[model samples]
Target: MAILKHVAGKSADYGAALDYLKYEHDEVLKKPLLDANGNWVLRRDILLDGINCEPELFDVECEMLNAQYHKNQNYDEIKTHHYLISFDPADKDECGLTGERAQAIGMEYVKTNFPGHQALVCTHMDGHNGSGNIHVHIVINSLRKLDVPQKSFMERPIDCKAGYKHHLTKDYLKHLQQSLMNICMRENLNQVDLLSPSVNKITQQEYYARQRGQINLDKLNAELIAEGFTPMRTKFQTEKDKLRDSITAAAKRAKSFEEFSRQLQAESGISVKDHRGRFSYLLPNREKYISARTLGTSFDRNHLLMLFESNALTAEREKQQWSVADPIAVLYIKSNLRLVVNLQDCVKAQQSRAYAQKVKISNLQQMANTIVYIQQHGYDSYDELKKARDELSAKMSDARNTAKSTDADLKRLNEQIHYLGQYLSTKATYKEFLQANNKKIYRSEHQEEIAKYEEAAQFLKRSSPDGTIPTMKDLRAEKEKLLSTRAVQYESYAYFKDYYHELQTACQNVDMILDTGHTQQHSRTHPKRSHEPSL
Candidate 1:
């Protein structure tokens, strides 16, 4: 995936910016980013739109312009904008995109986007942490040094004068993202959702801390074990991870952004703050806040708003609600829905063997109970236990059969629903499918649409064995029934399986008692009788 990051720097000395750009940073590369020839690799550098300056003299040109025109502007005002456009590491081999191609893309991007600006474009082969992704660094002077012609949208030309600073608007940033997305798509390179936030994003400090913490933890664990102490480790949870979870939980429960913010504060004690057109989260204990944009794409203010707004407006109302028929089944239904293991079942499994060892009943009582249980039916010793096990197994087999049937029914229903949904969704194209005079011409024009509709029709025909296609309402109703049946059958299957396993375990215990020396004890007790009647 491609990542676009912008870092704006300001300094009275333009040389500082140039030095920072050219010099090797310990974070970015272990050694200086060298070319294939092994000299200091500034070979990929290109100076754009500067007549008097080469790549090396680009900083001097910027300084000269600043001294001439923007002398009154604050020394601390942003004089340089550094942009990092990194491609997917795999794209180099997969898409055959070279460092030179990346450099060209960067140059063209700057030329098209920041016209009349003096910019230094350089491509680096090494990424931070040996990532090996081809990334470009474009450092453009804040001042527009050439006159830019006014577009049709503008009323007047923009002249290069004192304080002719470029405005980095939100739209401009969005345009950069869109441009990057288009470039990747055109090259058939792997691309990420440019508009979406990444799931896991850590700061440089957190990244280094995590790396160090892992090493320290391992060392500490070893030392603790040597001292015969309990080895413990601290789990690191960043503010972003905490906020992401809190926000997601809040989103599920809250309808609106206002409610989401309130719920988030209630849940995690992090209050939402929007100041000067930026979204930040205020930690309860911290005076300074961190930007939401820094956290990840999903936590961005606009994205969050869109998500919560959609939930409030449409999704929440459209969601289906299912109910358990039996009150006790509610627990099972919830366990299934959450995909959580049953704690009671886990505890029972752990304590199962203890049942054999800890039984307080005397042998006499056990014998009496076993005799009574056997007497209720025609049962004898091992045969009785085996018979009981077989009955339980049979019931389990039946339950499993029902469950399998339910699954098949659900699968068919789902496929029907999917095809029906596709047909409904692509109705506009299907209309064109029907209206086409020349079939070949229509297929050529609306190839994708025609293919989608044809696939759906074929599936529908195959599914409708009775030669009547199912209506959406009919399919929906059938789906609801199948889902309901699936839940019931699944629960029954679990219950029968557990019961059968208990029977199996009990039978195995009985077998252990019968096969061990306990059986010899009975034989020894009846030694006086040469022949004993089988019970």
Candidate 2:
């Protein structure tokens, strides 16, 4: 997955932007991480170069352009725009990604998307955090030196004109992100949903702050411990972190905006408000409110409403279930779904010595539900209950496996169909290149299209074991049939999954109650048995 990030530079000295890229920085101290030679240190697999300017004179060229364009002359104006494209660390081992290849992709990316700009493109193997992710840094001078041809994504007339600063509009940023995703897909590299909002969008500043905060907290904890004082907190949480936790916990059980707000206040004193369809959280004793976007996507209005809708549906389902039967106590199994419990034949399990340790006030509710479940299902013995659970589990597994297999096949067919289209689109270009007298020169002229055609052809050949390629029409027909099959398979899977969960919970609750009750009975009958050992 290639994650894209942008940071604008306001310093008038263009050299500062270049320095940060070329050198290493101690992130915590905001100073250069240097070597004995007094030069900035960096990873060994570093690839660096400048585009549309002399490598050494990149700053001079930018200064000359700025003077000529008479733009970005203000003291606090953005002098440069830095775009970072960080690829998945796993790609190095799984997909054989290297700094050199990543650099090439970065070059192609900048050339195609950011034309007519003096840009510096560089790649790093083990950046700041030393995560081993191959990331590219592309920093461009704010002023456009050459007029570019109008493109579909360009929004304004001055966008294509010289002397205009590079515009980082939301649309433009999205375009860049999509381009990265496309590149990842074409290259067979792991990719993420780059277009969607991040759930927890922690910036570099916040990330470092958390690290420093934790270190400070640990130090304070050690000092307090040495003085025979118990520290109140073992973990440190930033305000944003606290807010995220409070909002998520409140949202988990909240079914509406009003309920969510009340829960937030009652649980954590964080009052949430709706301002023009956006949710903002006001932390206790804080003057300013933090917007939902700053916290992450899951807290946004749309996501929260979707969560509430799901919660409402669950509530209705539970209501209907109870209306048809007794008040079934909720038996949480990871997911907080309400479940009816009853699998009462656990006499054999009650003999275990560990039962006494597990009993609590909650066991009473569980025991009642277990008895009701057994009576409703007519499970006469522990054997009968076990048999039912095992049978349902088998059915659930079969349906789940079938659905998963169908889904995988659909993905394969979709990728093949896309590859087939690519091959067809560029077949003419490949043919023309083959027939040309000067093969090398023609290949050079249409390198991109030819490369794409070959890549698609190879993939198609590998996919088709029988060497029989299906036409697009046939592929589409097959895909449709598979889609229909998948729908049916998923329906069965869903039904079995729900049934199995309820039955499984009933079995567990029954066993728990029997152990607790039987252990207590044995204790009353023979009080000294626990302390008395067999001779």
Q: What global local distance difference test value does model 1 have?
A: 0.66
lDDT of 1 by residue, 196-267 (tens): 556556765666665655567778668646744344334544555566676677777566768878766755
Q: Please, what is the whole-model Cα lDDT of each candidate in the order they appear?
A: 0.66, 0.80
Candidate 2 on 1-535: residue-level lDDT in tens? Answer: 8899888888788887677776787766667787998877854667888888866678899999999978878988999988999999899999999888999999999988988899999898875477878899999998888988999888998888888988889999999999999999999999999898898988877877987898899998896567444564677888899889878877788888898898777657778888899988898889899899987898899999999989989999987786566322222233332332222333433454354224333466566767766776678988788787788788788889999999999999999999999988997998788779999999999999999998987788778865444568557757866987899999877777776787778777666666767877987987665655321
Off by over 4 Å in 2: 36-39, 225-235, 312-535
TM-score of 2: 0.58
Candidate of highest lDDT: 2
- Per-residue error for 20 in candidate 1, Å, reads 3.8
* lDDT of candidate 1 at residue 143, scale 0 to 100: 85
CA lDDT, candidate 1, residue 7: 73
TM-score of each: 0.46, 0.58
